[model samples]
Structure formats: structure tokens, C-alpha cells
Target: MEPTRLVYEAWKRTEKIIQNTKDAKGNEIVREVEFYDPYDVKHMEKIDSRCFLCGETIQEGIATKHVFSDVFTDWNRSRYPIGTHVCPACSFTILTNPKNRTSLRNFSFVAEEKLHLPNRVEMRQFLVEPPEPPFLIVLAVSQKKHLAFKGTVSYNREIYTVMLEETEVIINRKEFTRLLAIVERFLFAFTKTEVQTGQYNQQRVLKFGIDRWEWFEEQVKPYRGTELLNVVMFVAQKVEREEDVLCFMGLGQKTKTPPQPHLSFMPSIEAETNDVDQADQICGDKLNDSQKQVQSEQIQLELF
Candidate 1:
């Protein structure tokens, strides 16, 4: 893939890192530094080689392991095999000139047949401008191990935040769309309000204070299965509107509830008989206890 203008600009801004070191005599000296030097011309030789990244033939190129040690880290041994070369241009792009270089551990890239966890500006360009579906961008949460990473996916040209578990990278479009619809419906149906106070009067003011991403994480991400549906259904039920429920469920049109069939004329005889039998059993027990109590009281009077 061709790098975007943003990537090129970022490359232009890159510069070599300089470091100070002490000599044997304890005199400090400044030197230009690089993780892997691309300009050490003593090792440069013309050989027919192919670049691993862009798949282009290179007349003057260096092995990927020499210059991409920091960028690919352990991936070089697995993803890009040995004897693979990278042209100077591609090396610059990958290394980003060292000053602003990024590693493969900061962002998660999920694509068909490949999954890479790393952050680079160039990678973001690809995600934002993908040719097809099933692409996701998850920013790694290096500080919090228990919390999920924040992810974004593009749908219909709109970006939505999604909470991703530590191991998750891909999400289906159907689920993404369903969640988007729920969030939109809730925001549309509810308008937040706050009370405002003045010297002489107090009034309530409407505010759009809730952020969609934060609300989703706090109120929706923790639930799953029937609980998730119930949460949304509860909100819809509170509004007490059929249209809201339909909209929250991603239904576009309102459906009329079918009228209940009349059952008054066709009552079940077995149910009626069971109810009568139960009632008779309860009354008979009560009567027997009352008669025994009265007999006991008469015998006590005769003894007296």
C-alpha cells in the first residue's frame, strides 16, 4: 500500500537522535545515533533483492533486520523472513527516521488473514480508508490491564467507539450497526436538562452533556445477552412509546399490536372444575375443625 500524505509529512519531520558519550579519557563527545544505520556505505553492495513491504525490486537496498529492528521487533523473524530487503525509502517509512519512530505494540490492526497489534500513523490511514469491511482500530491500553481497549470502526462514513476486550480485535458489522442504532435512539429520545439558578429566578435548562462513547462504556458495555437487551428495553419501556421501542431495536417502521382473540365464550371446563374442587376441599376442612371445637366445648360444660 502507498503511504498517505500524512505519513510522508511525518517522515519529513523525522530526524536522527543524538547522544553524548564519554571516551577512554573521560572526555564527553556527541555522536549521531540510530537503532540501525541505513547510511553505513561500507556494507552497501549492489545485489538483486526484493523489498518485503512493497514487493518491489531493489537495486540498492538493505536487509529488513538491519533497519527495522525497533519497528518490527520479534515480527521480523516470523512475518518477514530472512534475506528479505527493504529499499531506503521503505526503510525511512518504516523507521520514520527514528526520531518519531513507532513500534508494533501501540495499536491493534485487525484485517482479513492478518492481525497486528501496533500503532503507526500510516496504519491509521489504511484503517480509515479501507476498501472493504471487517477492519478495526483498537488503541492499546498500556496502563490498565483489566479495562478494555477503546476501538473505533467506520460505518456509513461515521465513526463509533466500541469497548474491546483484551483479546478481541474484530467485530461484525451487524452488531456494530445494532449498537449504533441503540445509542442514536437513546440520544434522540432523551434530552438532558439541568437546573440553573439566578438572583431572582430558577429555571431548568436543556443540555447535551452526555458523550456517546462514555455513555456506551458506562451504561452498555458491562451488560451482555438478555441483560443488554433488557437494559435497552427498559429505557424504551420507560418512554412508554411503541415507536421508541421499535426504533431502539433498529426497526424503521411501527407495527400495530395484533388484537387479543376473544376467549370469554370458550372457557375450559376442566379449569372451572379444578377451581370448584379446590374451593370445596378448603371449606370442608374448615367446617370439620369448627364442629370438633363445638363438641369439645359441650363436653367441658357437662363435666362442670
Candidate 2:
């Protein structure tokens, strides 16, 4: 990752931390400073995100949220700085222009998912002095709607106040359950398939088993033809990430094996059977060991 300018604090405890740096002449630099890690504080405010339009419970882990600027016509005549938001299907319906086919693509959504997460840019922490309460916390959040661009960050927190760039999202019991379900599904699907068959790490290798495909399809098919189109668009955006994971797991690649001379299976089988019988009659214990080895080899497709 490229270096970016950021002020980071090292947390010693929930209420102790130290901010150890500052910018120098437009160059990112660290200096001697100290504070407490507020994360260890016994009491801290927690937040949760719900669908503003439909009132449906949005899962925090998989829920899509984006950040965008809404124009304000107040004294400042400034844009309501962008902030992170829940990408509700209903909210899309309420905020979008149906007549403008590309309006959704152009507006709303976090311009990019990776950029939307606070922790994506790794900020190094240093200990120049002691530690403060309510120090900076790195958070990752997602909206149901995909960003139009792949790497944009939202500044919506600026809307509420200049102090916070975005409101903190509080996680709750129901949201935790939803996140667990998605993770479980991903794990099961990951383990059920062959790891690298023909070719390796190709996007086209993202084919899923019939059952796994059906599971994902069912959840998404409901909105396949919806006028709101947010869900459909979001799924399309997720396709790239899905492909990346499949490749990372070796599901989209072929395993390599050494080339060896081969014998006909029929002849090989007959010879092995004859050899086993002969060994059994001649050396009982050694023959038993040999048979066990052969059984294991059979189970392993004789890869060795």
C-alpha cells in the first residue's frame, strides 16, 4: 500500500493512547506526542445502521452503504459533505430518478468500497508519549449499494459536524447474526469444490457448483428485474470481489503435478494383485504393511 498522510494513535488500553506524529511541510511525519487509548474505556457510545427508507434491518457486515454529497442551499451554499449511509433498496427507490437511466450510476454509493473503509489505508502507530479518551478508531462499513467508482471515499460525516467525517456505526445482536450467516455460507461454498482444475487464477474459472450457485441466486433473484435496481447493481459490483476470492483460494486455477511414465491401468492392477499375493505368502508382516500402504495410495489417487 502507498503511504498516505494520517494521524494515528497507539492504544495501551480502552482509555489510554498516544498520538505520535504530525505533518511537516506537506510531508507526512511523526513527532513525540502521547495520549490514552479510549477504546478500553468502560463506557463508549455504540451505533447501528438501519434502512432509513424501508425500516428493514440491514446486516452490518454485508449491508451496502455509500457516501455522497447532497447539495445544501443554506447560508454557506455548500454541499452537505458526503457521509457513509445504509444502501437500502427502498432508499434507492426514494432517492433515485427513474427517468434518468444512469442517475443511480452517477450519484450516491461510496465512490469505492476499499476507499470507503477507514482502515484500508494502514496508518502506522508510534509511542512518542503517554496515552487520551475517544482516540481515533479505524472502522470498516459497507452499504448495500455499490459505488460507481472502485476506489472513492465518502466524506458524509462532514455533514453533521466538522469534527467527525462519518458517524460511528454501532453493531448489534441481529446484525451479528446476519454477518455470521454470510461468513458461514462463504466458508461452506469455499470448501466444497475442487481447488484448481484446468487453468489457474482466471476470471472465467469462477464457476460454482450447482447447489452453491442456487443459494446465491435465490437471495439475489428477487430483485433481478426490480425498477429500483440497486440490488442488481450491487451484485454486479460484488462479482469482481467474488472472482478475486476464488482465485486467491486456488478454486480458479489448476494444480501442478510432475510428468511420469504411465502404464495401462489393467496391466498395473493385475501386476499389483499378483505382487500382493506373492508378498503375503512369502513375508506376512511386511506384506501386511505393504497392503496398508497400497490402500492409502489408492485413496490418494497415487499422486506420490
Candidate 3:
């Protein structure tokens, strides 16, 4: 079935459960509401309007932002432009549930395939786990405006900037796969630190500590092109060799030479060097005895 039809059917199923429920004293609850039928011939003769979302003919009922404010109020304006009419099917699909609304924003559906509504398990997964790759993460404020909605992915010495527009989602799967792989490698190289929290004044409070993701993000900003892959690989290699990963990634180093620019799109070496001094102060002491021995041996080899 088409995505719209599938969504509409799913909404009907959910609506049936809600409408057919019994209240106290075995009373069948009934709601006074009008449901639209897009295929009905009599309804089709009423108006010749088109849906703003799927561009389908509005056979029966029409929906507007004012009518369905709950659905459209938090919608992305680029995806759902203002002053656009919604067809019955499109309106019902969006009004299915809050989960469906969230899925619509964060996921791209195949045009010919049926769109599946996100279940509770999938919703939980979105919070605790990272998506496989080539996925969309909608970053928007309360007004539903895009915020910093662009990122570059590097793979096999080639860089691809995945422009995340408010209207569409475009991604190069190969580049995204490579980018995620590098991120996994970078994460695996580090030792997992336990976060401690305590109950204070009827709320759970963080005692101390933060994830290394901020450091990763800072180090990665300067190398968005081909050098990004190399930098990640270098850090992974250092970790394997028992060398200090933070120092290699320019986090724990007091003084360092600026990296020479290789690509035309690469940021200025001097600008990238500016943040190193600040990072040096936050260097972690995670190196073990073996790591110290490895560093000493490397120094001796350099001297020889």
C-alpha cells in the first residue's frame, strides 16, 4: 500500500480502540466527530481542493493549521508550509499520535513503500542508542526553525557535505557509514567512565563528570574534510599502541606545531591552532604504565 493509505489505515485502527472504549458501569463511550472519506463520490463533489502535504486531491474534508493547530503548531514550516490545505488522509496520518509526528520529522520514508509508525521500543531506542547510519536528526527550536543544520562526512579520503535542508533529507550512505565507523572507533578507544548521580531535594543531581563527546566535537570541527578520517585513524592507532589518545588528538599537548593544510576547503591552520592551548589545560590522566613505557620507547627511538 502507499504511505498515505498505510498511515490512514493505522490511524483508523487507533481511532477504533479509542472510540470503542467503555467507561465506568459498562457504558460504551461515544464521541460526536466527523471522519472524512477520500474515496467517497458524494464527498468528492463538495470541493476541488488539493492537499498541501502530499499534493493529493482533497476528495472530502479539508484541514488547515487553524483546524488542526495541535498537529501544525510544532510542525517544521519548510516541510509543512504555512497557509497550505491538508487532505483527509494526510491530516489523519499526522493526527495519528505524537510518535508518528516525531517520526515524520526525523525519518525519511521511501516513496513507494509503506511508512511504519514508530513503536514504543523504537522510541526508547532513539533516546539511548545511535542509529545505524545515514539517518536524519532534526535539530529545531520551539519555532520549528532549523538550527546549525549542515554537516560534512568524510570517507576514503573524500568529503561529502550532507546538506540537511528543512524541506528534504539528503544523505550519501557510504560517507555516512564511514563517518559512523570512525565515530565508533573513536569511542571504543576510550575507557568508559561511570557517571555518578545523587538524590538531592527530591531530584536526581549529577555529582560530577561529563562525557568526552564535547572534546571529540571540538577536535573534529577543524578537520571536516579528507583529514578527518586520518585524524580518527591516528587516534585509534595511538590507542592500540598504548599511547595517549588525548595528546595525539591535540587535547593533552602543551605546545604543538600547526597542521599543514592539504585541501582548499580546509580551515586555516593558524585558526585551528588557537584552541589547542585551552584544550591542553583539560588533558586527562588516563595513561597506564604500559602507555608510559610505550611513550618512553618512542622517545628513545627518536633520539637514536
Number of the top-ranking candidate, with TM-score as the measure? 3
Write candidate 3's Cα lDDT for 239-291 as tens digits: 35312444444432234433322232333222333333233223223445665
User: Which lDDT tens digits does candidate 1 get at residues 246-285?
Assistant: 3223212112222112121222222223322332343223
Model 3, CA-based lDDT: 0.33
Clash count list over all predictions: 2, 33, 0
lDDT of 1: 0.34
Clashing pairs in 1: 107-118, 107-119
Instruction: Provide the global lDDT of candidate 2 against the true structure.
Output: 0.25
Q: Estimate each model's TM-score.
A: 0.31, 0.20, 0.33
Name the top lDDT candidate.
1
Would you list the clashing residue pairs of candidate 3? Answer: none
